[model samples]
Target: MKIWVLRHGQAAAQAATDAERPLTAAGQQEVRLMASLLQGQPLDAILASPYLRAQQTAALVCTELGYERGVATAPWLTPDDDPCEVLRYLAERQERNLLLVSHQPLVSQLLSMLCEGHRGAHVPMPTAALACVDTDFVAAGLGSLVLHRTPADLSA
Candidate 1:
């Protein structure tokens, strides 16, 4: 299985609520640039957090990649959600390639947990950052981190 995790782009500092917070103009551009990296990849599914910023990011990715299936809003992709639950959810899915658009701590924790046995590694996922992991099955430490890129890397 191949899993691609993307942290939503930079958002405005304030909003009525965290979930309602939309991406800034720069955030939209960052997400578009990051999405271009996946242009030729075959993504079976695109899952994203319900947060406004994540949703916007996913949309940008869909546009960039020309992914017509659209994004599925997932509650488990929230910043504070447990990585274990995400693993279980991935285990249940049958997609060979999956893209996950989510927030900070969840993206970092999920990537670290996937690459490290017990979430020991500190995987820093800045806004618009992306990471790819490959594994025969979804589980802690069983996966290998094949790629990690941030917007800075893409823009450069």
Candidate 2:
């Protein structure tokens, strides 16, 4: 299975609530750039946090992919949710490719947990960054990090 973890674009600092935060103008543009990197791929499903920023990010990617089904919102993808449940969920899914749009700390923790067997590797995830993993399945320390790209990296 190939899993892609994408951090939501940079959001406005002020919002009614953290979950309600929307992406800033720069954030929207950066996400579009990142989306371009995955265009033309047969990506199967997109699972994202219910937060507005993440929802917006997923929408942009889906647009770029020409996907019309809308994104599946998963509670486990929330900023503070545990990664184990998500790993279990992915292991049970039949799709070969999955994209997860989420927030920090959880996103950063997921990167280390997926790449390293443990959560020690501090993978720096700037907003709109993406990391691709090649794994037989989703589990603690069971996947291999194949790619990590930021919008600037793609632009340059």
Candidate 3:
């Protein structure tokens, strides 16, 4: 299985609620750029944090790729949520390729957990960044980093 993890795009700083925070104009454009980069891939599924920012980013990517949104909301992808459960869930999924759109610390933590098998080691996943991992879904913690890209890299 191949998993693509993406951090949510930049969002407004002061929103009425954290869950209500939406992406900025620049963030939307950055997401478009990221979507374009992923256009030709055969993504089997998209799992996202329930936060508005992450949901919007996933929606944009699905629209650009012409794939009906097969998005699943996982609480583990939410900010500060435990990522081990998310990893476990992904390991059981039947999809060969999955995309996950989420927030900072959680996204960062999840990548580190997937790559290193533990957390606390920082893997900075900047806004609109993506990390691709190839692994055997049946065997947990067996994966290799295939690619990592940030919006700036895409722009360049």
Candidate 4:
């Protein structure tokens, strides 16, 4: 199975609430570039944070890919949520391809937890960056990082 983890692109510096934050114009372009770069990747499903920025990012990705369905929103993918919950949930799914659009710490921590045994590993996930993990299981250290790219990397 391959899990594609994506971080929402740059967002407004301030909002009424953290979840209310929206993506900037550059952020939309970043996500569009990222989506274009990922056109060849197989995606069976997309799960994303409910935050406005993440939702926007996922929407753009879904639109680009012509997924034709609303992306699933998982509360457990919130920035402050636990990665284990997502792992547990993923363990039951049969889909070989999945995409997760989320925030900063959550995305990085989940990558570390899957590629390393813990969340202490340094995995840089700048805005609109993506990390692809290939593994048979969802356990820590069982996966290999197949690809890690950013909008800047793809844009170039």
The prediction achieving the highest lDDT against the true structure is: 1
Which lDDT tens digits does candidate 4 get at residues 41-150?
A: 77889999999999999999988888776799988889988877778888888889999999878888899988997888889999999899999988877889999999
- Give all TM-scores, in the order shown: 0.98, 0.96, 0.93, 0.96
Residue 20's lDDT within candidate 3 is 88
Computed on alpha carbons, the lDDT of every model, listed in order, comes to: 0.92, 0.89, 0.83, 0.90
Top candidate by TM-score: 1
Spell out the clash pairs found in candidate 1: none
After superposing all C-alphas onto the true structure, candidate 1 shows an RMSD in angstroms of 0.7
Instruction: Give candidate 4's whole-model lDDT.
Output: 0.90
**Model 2 ranges with Cα > 4 A deviation:** none
Query: Which model is ahead, 3 or 4, in terms of TM-score?
Result: 4
Better candidate by TM-score, 1 or 2? 1
- Give the 10-residue window scoring lowest on summed lDDT in candidate 3: 136-145
Q: Write candidate 1's Cα lDDT for 36-103 as tens digits.
A: 88889999999999999999999999988889999999999999999989999999999999999999
Q: How far is candidate 3 from the true structure (C-alpha RMSD, Å)?
A: 1.5
